[model samples]
Target chain A: MEFSSKLLQNAVHEMSQLPGIGKRTALRLVLHLLKQPEERTEHLSNALVKLKSEVNFCKKCHNISDTELCEICASTKRDGTVVCVVEDIRDVMAIENTSQYNGLYHVLGGKISPMEGVGPQDLNITSLVQRVKEGTIKELIFALSSTMEGDTTNFYIYRQLEGTEVATSTIARGISVGDELEYADEVTLGRSILNRVPFESSIKAT
Target chain B: MEFSSKLLQNAVHEMSQLPGIGKRTALRLVLHLLKQPEERTEHLSNALVKLKSEVNFCKKCHNISDTELCEICASTKRDGTVVCVVEDIRDVMAIENTSQYNGLYHVLGGKISPMEGVGPQDLNITSLVQRVKEGTIKELIFALSSTMEGDTTNFYIYRQLEGTEVATSTIARGISVGDELEYADEVTLGRSILNRVPFESSIKAT
Candidate 1:
C-alpha cells in the first residue's frame, strides 16, 4: 500500500548520511533519479565502482590521477622549484582553473584537527618533508582556509620546514569585496590593519 | 591526469540536470559518494532502477501502485460513493498520511495549463466523467491547490459534472496558523472571513 520501497528507503537513508542533505531532500533527489532513464542511474553506479578501480593517487603530489604523476606535476612548463600546498585535490583544480598559478601542487590529504582525532601523522606531511629534503623546491606556499584548524596545521608545517632553507609564505588574508565596516568583526578588522599594504592608483568614491 | 574521473564528472553532470542541483553541489555529492564504500552507491542505483520498474498507475484512480489496481482502489473498506479529486499522486500520499479520510480518490494526472500546452484533454477528465456517469459516486470533493490553474481546472470539472446529481464541493482555503492581520493578503483575509464557522474556544496568544 505504501509507495516507499524498502530498497529505495535504504538508498535515501544512505544519501541523507552525506553532508548538507536532509531526509526530505534525499527523498526528492531519489524520486527525481527514479524518473530518469535507466542508463542515467547506471552511469552514476558505474562511475562509483570505476572511481576506485581505475584511479590512483599520483606518486609525486598524492592527487587522484590515472597516471603515475598528475598533469600539473608532469608538465614541463610548470615551475617545479615552487610548490603550492593545499588540503585536497579539489583545491588543486580550483587553483588550476584560475590559470594564475603554474607551480606544482602537493595535497596534504586533510588538515590537522585534534577535535576530529586527525593529526599530522594522518596527513601526507612526511612525503612533503621528503620532497623538500631533496632540495629541488625553492619556495613553499600555503593556500589553506583561514579556519582555526587550518591555521594550526600551517603553523605545524612551518615548524617542520623551518631549517630546511625553503622560503615559506601564506596567502594574503583580508576583507572581501562588498563587505560592511560596521558588520566586520574585531578579529577581521585587526587582521586587515595588520596586513595593510600600500595603495596605488587611489580614486575618490562617487 | 585530470583531477576528476571521467565517470564521476559525467555522473555529477547528469545529477546537476535535476531541479535545484547545480554543478558545485553535484560535485560535492559525487566526492562524498567516492569516499564511501561501493555498496552504498550500488544500493542507490538499484533503488532508482527499481522505483521505475516496480510501480505503475492504478487502473481506477490512477494512484501509484505495484499492481494494476492500486491498494486504495481494491480496498473494500474504503467508500466508493465519495471520490476526492487531486492534481497528482503526491497529493494522494499527503492526504493518506493524514488518515482523516476513508473515501476513494481520483488522480487528474495534471491540471489545465494553456501556456504550458496542457489542457483538459491532457488530464484523465474523460474517465472521471465516465465514473460519475456510472451512478456509483454520490459526492465529489475537489482537493486542489488554490492557484489560478487549479481554480480553472476545478471550474472546468464542475461544469462537466453540472447535470450530474452528485454533490460537488471544494476544500476551504484560509489564512494559515500565526496569521498577522497586517501581513494577510486580501484573498486570504476574504477567504478566512467568508468561510468563518462557530468558534469552539477563545483564541490564545502564545
Candidate 2:
C-alpha cells in the first residue's frame, strides 16, 4: 500500500518485518503510534534499543538475562541438578508460571527443524551436552512441545548422551485435565491409553 | 508472568501497550526479534524513533507529508475546489487507491465520540472550517466511516458550514458492488433503495 509520508512508510516497513504482522496491520500500528503521545513512541524505541544492546544470554543455560548469568542459573534456591529443557524463553516463562517445577531450565533456543533449515548445530545443544558432561546435573527433562521437531531434537540429544550417566526423560503427553476424552485427537487418546499409569501413581501426583 | 530478565520484561511491557497487542503476543514478537540478527531490532527501533521525531503534517490538508504542503494540496491536477473530509490518513490512502476521487483531502485526525471523550475541539475541524470560509473550496464531501461517531462528526461539520456558500454532500452508502441484495444488511439495503438514483447514474458509477 502507498503511504503519504516516507517516514510512515519506513516505520510500517520495519514493523511488518515481524513474523505475523502484515503491511496493513503495520500501517495501523504506526498510525496508532502517531495518534498517541510522543513519549509512548520514545519509550518503545528506547526499550527495544536497550534490550538489543544490553540483553545477555546466560553463560550456563542460554536463557536471556540482563547480566552474564541468568537469574535461574545463578540462584541457589532452584535445583540446578535437574535442568528442564525448552525451545525458548517463552517456554521458560510458561514453565516458571506453573510453579510446579523447582528445577533450573536449559533453553535450547529452538528445536531442530529441517524444513526451516535449523539443525542441532543451530541450537544450544552443544553447550547443553557440555554442561551435562561436566557432571553435576543428575536428570534432564525434555519439555519441548510434542511436535515432530521436538521428538527429533529429543532423540538427537539422547543419542549424544550415550556414554554419559545422566538420565534423560521427556515430559508426558495426555489430554488436558478439563478436556473430554472424546474430544481428544485419536493419536493423543491412543498414547494416553498406552502410557496409562497405575491407579495409586495417579493419586500420588495430586 | 515472571521474566528471568528485567530488560525482556520492560520491552514486552512497552510493546504490549500498542492497541490490539497483548502480553502473550508481545512476548512472542520480542522473542522473535531476539532470534533475528541484532541489526533487525536496531532498524525497527531507529525507524520508529525517526518517524516520531521527524514526521510532519501538511500545512494545508493536514495529511502527513515531508514538506510544508501535502502532495495532493500542492498538485495543480487535483480539484482543489472539491475537498473530501476524512477521519485520518488511512482514509486518505484508501481513497487514493481507488483513483476515483481527484479532490484534495482534509483529515480530521479522529471522529467525535463521547464514549472515548473525543470532541470537535480535539480534532482539526477548526482548521477545516477556516479553510472553507476562505471560499476557495466550492464543495465539501464527508467521507468518514458509517459509524455513529462518524455521523456525529459529519453533522457537526455540516452545522459549522451552514452559513458558507460551499455545497456539501456525503459519500454514498449502499451494498457493495458484488454483494447480493438478500445477503446485504437491512439498513444498507434500505438506504440504497431510499437513495436510489437514475439508472444512468448507476451505470456511470461502474
Candidate 3:
C-alpha cells in the first residue's frame, strides 16, 4: 500500500514489524493516530521509549521489573523457598491472577524449543540452577505448558539439580473442573486417572 | 491484572489508548517489544514521534503529504478540472490503486456525523468550495462511502455548489462485479435497476 507521506509510511513500517500486525493493520493504526490529537501519539511514543530505556528484569527471578528485584521476588509474604518456573511474565500474571500459588516465580523467559533455536542456555536456566544451589529453595514447581518444549526444559532443569537437595514437582495436568471427563484429551484423562488423588483429599477441596 | 513493574504498566496503559487495542493486547505487544533488542523499540518510538511532529497535509487537496501540494494535485497529467471528493487519504489510495480515474482528489478528511459531533465545518469542505469558486474545476464527483453520513456530506457540498457552473455527480452504486443478483442488497439492486445504462454502452465496455 502506498502512503501519501514518507513519515506516515515509516511509522506504519515500524508498527507492522510487530508480531501479528500486518501492513494493512499498520496503516489503519497509523491513520487512526493521524486523526487523533498529537498528544496521543506523543504519549504512545514516550511510553515505548521509557519502557525500553528504564525497564529492568528482577535479579533473582528474571521477571520484568522497574528495579533490581520484582515485587514477587522481593515480597516477604511470598514463599521464596518454593519457586514456580514459567515461560514468561505473562505466565507470572496468569498464575498470580489465580491467587492459588504463594510461591515466588522463576521466569525462564521462554521454553527450550529446538525448532525455534531456543536452547536451555538462551533462557534463564543458569540463574535458576544457581538459585537452587543456594540451598534456600526447598521445592521447584514446573509451571510451563504441557508441550514437548516444556517437558524438555523441565527435564533439563531437573538434571541440573541432580546433586542439589531441592525437591522438584510439576503442576497437575487434568480436566478443567467444569469440563466433561469424556471431552478431555486422552493424554490428560489418562494422566489424571493414573495420578488420581485420594478420594478424601478431593472431597475436602470441594 | 497486576503488573510487576510500574513502568511496564504505564506503557501498557498508554499503548491501549490506541483505537481497537485493549489492555491485554497492549501488554502482549509491550512484552514482545521487551523481548526484542532495545533498538526495535527505539525505532518504533522515534518513527511515531517524527510522524506526529513533522507530517504535513497537501494545502490544495488536504491529503496527507510532505509538501504544500500532494503529488496528484501537482501532477500535470492528472485532470485538475475533474475533482473527486473523498472522505480521507485512504479513499484516495483505493481509487488510485484502481488506475481507472485520472482526476485530482479533494479529501474532506471526514464525513459529517452529528452523533460524533462532527460537522461540515470540521472537514475540508470550505477549501473544496473555494477550489470550485476558482472556476478551474469543471466537474466534481462525490466518491464518499455509501453510508448515510457520506450521503449527507455529499448533499451538503452539492448545495454549496448550487450557483457554480461546475457539474456535480456521485460515484455509481450498483451490484459489484462478480456479485450474484439474488444475494445483492435491496437498496443497491434497486438503484442499479433505476440507473440502468444503455445495453449497447455496457456491451461496448466489456
Which candidate comes out best when scored by TM-score? 2
Clashes of each: 0, 0, 0
DockQ score of each predicted structure, in the order shown: 0.35, 0.84, 0.82
TM-score of 3: 0.95
Q: Is the docking of candidate 1 incorrect, acceptable, medium or high quality?
A: acceptable
> Higher DockQ: candidate 1 or 2?
2
lDDT: worst 10-residue window of model 1 chain A: A197-206
TM-score of chain A of each: 0.89, 0.96, 0.94
In CAPRI terms, model 3 is classed as high
**lDDT at B27 for candidate 1?**
72
Which 10 consecutive positions of candidate 3 chain B have the poorest summed lDDT? B14-23
Q: After superposition, how far is residue A167 of candidate 2 from its true place, in Å?
A: 1.1
* Candidate 2 lDDT tens digits, B6-117: 9999999999999889999999999888888989998998899899889999998899998899889999999989999999999999999999999989999999999999
- What's the residue-level lDDT of B69 in candidate 2? 93
lDDT of 1 by residue, A151-203 (tens): 99999998998779999988777776589978988888889889876665223
